[model samples]
Target: MTVFRLPDLGEGLTEAEILEWKVAVGDVVTVDQAVVEVETAKAAVEVPVPIAGVVTELCAQAGSVVSVGEPLIAVGVAENSETARYREEEQAGSGNVLVGYGTSTAHRSRRRARPTAPPPHGRVPRVISPMVRRLAKEHGIDVAALTPSGPGAIVLRKDVEEAIAAAARPPETVDEVRVPLTGVRRTMADRVSRSRREIPDATTWVDADATRLVKLKRNIRNTDPDARVGMLALFARICVAGLRRFPELNAHVDAERHEIVQVKGVHLGFAAQTDRGLVVPVVRDAHRLTLAELATELARLTDEARAGRLSPADLTGGTFTLNNYGVFGVDGSTPIINHPEAAMLGVGRVSEKPWIHKGKVRSRQVTQLSFTFDHRVCDGGVAGGFLRFVADCVEHPEALVTHL
Candidate 1:
């Protein structure tokens, strides 16, 4: 029997919560077949087994957190050349983790059943991932009845969600509700609390006439309809430019070192709300990207965030952040800074409002931009200047050419 231990996922992650097991005891398995899904502080990842054999034992129960280097699964294998080679690879440290490990194309047919008894049809549901199974099970929906929308006729999370929407849910009576914070939500709470406790933070706001920016996007689209330059991308460009002018805002207050380390490039992060929770995906080297390039990257990251496919590297090393709460149709918000990042810029909704244009009252597109920063990094004057620069770019996008 070969014991497969949980290797480090990445970014020094020490523990992961067992989401579900793909295989059970007495089920035959192959090398590199994903045996379980685990949720780390950063993201949800599938861990694969190295040896090819029968699953003897599962080390931990679902929903339990397992530390790194702990036994995850046990596989029984025959004493042959292949088994010896696998053991040798494990000794060399390549067989424990998924990263840098190669998977073989040779795999036998595998089968898995729900924790409960087989359905009336006596066939297992063709589900794509453990998450989809969990979603269907949570809603008490029959997985086999749900139509598959994913490739290869596999049931996806969206299919389960659609079924849930169509099915009427009966209201339940309950007392006070309590939810244990786990996974990403838990990490977010810890970071926010730490930021409030350690950093001296302040907020500043300004209302800008976004009519010109709106017109600019329309003009660009008219020239090339394929250019999906969104408002958030334009705001990202403006924020990157502002950071170039005020490098202090693009820095971290290293209390241990008693120094302010200015980050080298504009690794811009933006807040994206997913079904799991709020996640900020960072775009590295934003200063070097064009407006169109920024839009593409932002759209890609947003899709990855919503689909729960973002990796640990895609979510860290952010020097600054852009929060577009405008999507929620809110007027303004004083958001807490993403811990360790020096500052964050929040953009409110762009709505039609009465404004003075050329000394005359007129209806125009307007928005409020809120800036939050750690006071230890810079004074209010610098914060105000950076906010003003961003506002000016929004009001008069022509000024962006100078910064570019």
Candidate 2:
């Protein structure tokens, strides 16, 4: 029998909640086939089968939380079979097969710490785990050059402290700053810091007359009684339509690999404000839903998120994100892109203003639309066009009604 443990999905992710199982006991599964969907703190990811065999048992049930290294499933293989023979050979050090997230037996061995002694033959020495040694090799760093500061002559985490720290100047004392880095502040700080350091962002703002849209929403609320469309719903609808026209905006920047991934589907993320922090629950396939449907989903998602009942799946797979800072009494602001996504739109509050309408000064509800995009994937022209499309849609609400 082959035991499949829940794999580490990402850095620092220890446990995951089993959201669904694609296979059941007695079902045959092939290697690398998706067998379950697990929800972690970061996102919902599908776990694949590690071996080809009939599932003998499921150790965890749906909605049950499991930690790493805990067996999730057991697959039964035939005795003296090709897979079993290969496993025996692997146990004998003939190279183990890496399937799904399975690690090799070589990684399971414990390393002995170095003894306290003077330099041996004038050679530098270091103590580290087998995993750290492999990581050092992959990073082209000399492990022997590092000093071990851990107990029992082992290299603890601090041993890899910044190489240039010794030569750096000490900082002068300043006023102490202390604040709780939890909830919204922490998330905003991390996102903004990363965006400032990693992404080359450029923002464009366009002031548009949203009078027609506001009037349309008011009319809908009055007529339907059950259908209440807000400005955010209209904005989401406009963004979906704009993406169809300019698909390049609906993309993600893979900075590590230096690639821009354009997604085909429209998973729109709406920034919902709560007392704790701002949560963005995504509406999968927002383009497929009508304005009313989008409004309803947005309402439901916000309600669930505020109630702390949002599942991990509701937060992932967002191709585009929209932040309505206008609801907070802000006129306009540049919003940071959700990591892995290339662009984000900030919708400002709609306020009545006097504007020149066909050679006459008239009152109109004007709102500012801010588009912040990763310059690496999008240029000024593309970003401007997307903003213009949204502005046009909001100004002419009839267009959205006809299109939908």
Candidate 3:
């Protein structure tokens, strides 16, 4: 039995949730054939089998999560099976096989970390990693002249570069920082850097009386559990209503066209903080969804987001974003605009505080809402209006229908 282990989808995700099994036991699969859809923290990806054979065992059930490097499927190969002939032809053409995540191409054999060495060297030492040789060649530095610095007396890239640098000038003190920009962190770095570089962003904020919104949610929960609205859904509805009044905040700046692209629909994305990282899963056509529908979707997407089961489609094409930093028990935050979109609405935690509602002083639920916008799309007037509209809706949820 040939075991096909689960492969790393990306971003060094250690585990994946099996969403579906495409092939059952006794079903035949070919090279690079997708056998299952597994969801990583970033997206749902179809994991493919690397060999051609009859499926013998389905190691994981649908919805069960499995770790990387664990056997995902087992395939039985007969002597006369096409897998042998396919592998033979594959060897003749290319030495390796495609594994997972649709990374199929001419699979070239990766070089070993070090090359073979001579038995006894009258010269300096052995070289490790072909990169060391390449570095030495590029700099006209002789490996035999420099002492090996790594384990097993092997010449390293750093050693070669240091030798060249020492030859260039005497060792000098310098200040420089280096880091690996990779995975989701790398993606965030790129997007944030681009946003800072490209978008002229500005932030504005205001405090809202969320007592009525809280009371409304509480009343709904008390009466009907199924129709209850979450704070996120309430804010989402208000945001959609605000966007209707101040549509400029719900637009994107088109670089090529040099115009503000106003989106007709609200693909509302909410910031979901997870163990992996902060990901925004968009609820498509959110403006059309009722409060109950929005609550359901928000709950489902939030669950999927936590499970790392959101697909790529769920992560992109957002018209606007809602960030509730209050879940972390904070008052407010100037949320960064998810690029391509002009604005983001931030909700801080609602807390009990002394306030004068009507003629009497009492403790009421209060929360701060932060609104950030791209300066290119609109100025302070438009931003302030959008923010005030949202606040008004939060302070009095009745403004929702009027704006809609």
Candidate 4:
């Protein structure tokens, strides 16, 4: 019997709440086949089996949270050359076998075992456990150079810890506080890192006279006292209009296929600060929704996010994002492009500012708008046009009527 641990469900998520099992004991499975659905703080993800075999055990039941490197399931397989290699991977915790969100892919075959030999003078040692790998990675230790004390020259956790201690023997030290990054925060960190690494992003900003937009909101509320229209919904409508004008910004690059995919409709996402963490709840088909409808949906999603009741579907598939950092009492931000999305528009706080209006200097309601775009999808011209259009609509709310 081989025990398979709950692999790190990307972004170094330490634990997941098991939602349901796709297989039970005695069920036959294939490599890379999803066997269970688990929920991390970020989203619901399906965990795949690393080795093909008959299920012998379901270690954790639904609604139970299992941490990384803990046994998830046990599979029974007949002894063979392939089984031996799979066992090696199971012991080593090869994370490549861990599938991505909601999908699985083919697993890479491991090399056949070589004759037993000592570690070469100038080679990295063999790492055989996830704990050791994580320990070394966290401490910036070169496992290859470490002298392993385990059998077959496998690097162990103690080896890594010892190396870390030796390197960190500081002459002067204070009590250090360590906070573990788990769940949503860890997932967010991973995505942000990937976005910065993969995206050639650029930002442009403009000061917009939001006096008309604010007045439009008041007029609508006056027309219908029960109308739920708010500043965020108005901004969502503006973003939808901007996307319709510049469809290029409503798309993502398919890095593997070497293609740019233009999304069909606007799935508008807005950043909301929730008790769990920061989450972007998507408003699907925002283009089809009326201003009032947009307000209603945004309000609903925000409530759901705050209550920590949002599901994975509520958080995925956003073609464009509208970030109102102004709610946090900030004036402006050069927002990061949400991974897989082409652009995001950030709104600063709307305040009374001195401005030239009707050819005269006056105090006007103004806000700064910052647009950040993935340069890979479009150049500065397209990004500039989208921001300019949004700003124009903000200055003259009636301009949206032409597009709506």
TM-score per candidate, in order?
0.57, 0.54, 0.55, 0.57
Q: Candidate 4: where are CA atoms >4 Å away? A: 1-176
What local lDDT score does residue 376 receive in model 4, on the 0 to 100 scale? Answer: 89
Question: Which runs in model 1 stand beyond 4 Å of their true positions?
Answer: 1-174
Question: What would the C-alpha RMSD of candidate 1 be, to one decimal place?
Answer: 28.4
Scored against the true structure, residue 108 in model 3 reaches a CA lDDT of 25
Which residue pairs of candidate 4 clash? 124-144, 125-144
In model 1, residue pairs whose N, Cα or C atoms come closer than 3 Å (at least 3 residues apart or on different chains), thus clashing, are none
**What CA root-mean-square deviation does each model show from the true structure?**
28.4, 30.3, 28.2, 29.4
Alpha-carbon error at 247 in model 3, in Å? Answer: 1.3
Write down the RMSD of candidate 2 (Cα, Å).
30.3
lDDT of 1 at 40: 62
**What lDDT does the true structure give each of the candidates?**
0.85, 0.75, 0.77, 0.81
Q: What is the lDDT of residue 106 in candidate 4?
A: 67
Better of 1 and 3 by TM-score: 1
How do the residues 286-322 of candidate 3 rate in per-residue lDDT, one tens digit apiece? Answer: 9889888999999999999889788888888899999
- Report the lDDT tens digits of candidate 4 across residue range 1-404: 88878765666667666655777777778777777876564555677775777788889865466888898999897787766876686577666534452223665223221223444785644544554566688889988888876544555556777899999997776789996778667766777789899999999999999998999999999998676898998999999998998999899999999999999899999999977788899999999999888999999999998987888899889999999999988999999888989899999999999999989999999999999999889998998899999999999999889999
Q: For model 3, state the Cα shift of residue 62 in Å.
A: 86
State each candidate's clash count: 0, 1, 1, 2
Q: Which residue pairs of candidate 2 clash?
A: 326-349
lDDT order of candidates, best first? Answer: 1, 4, 3, 2
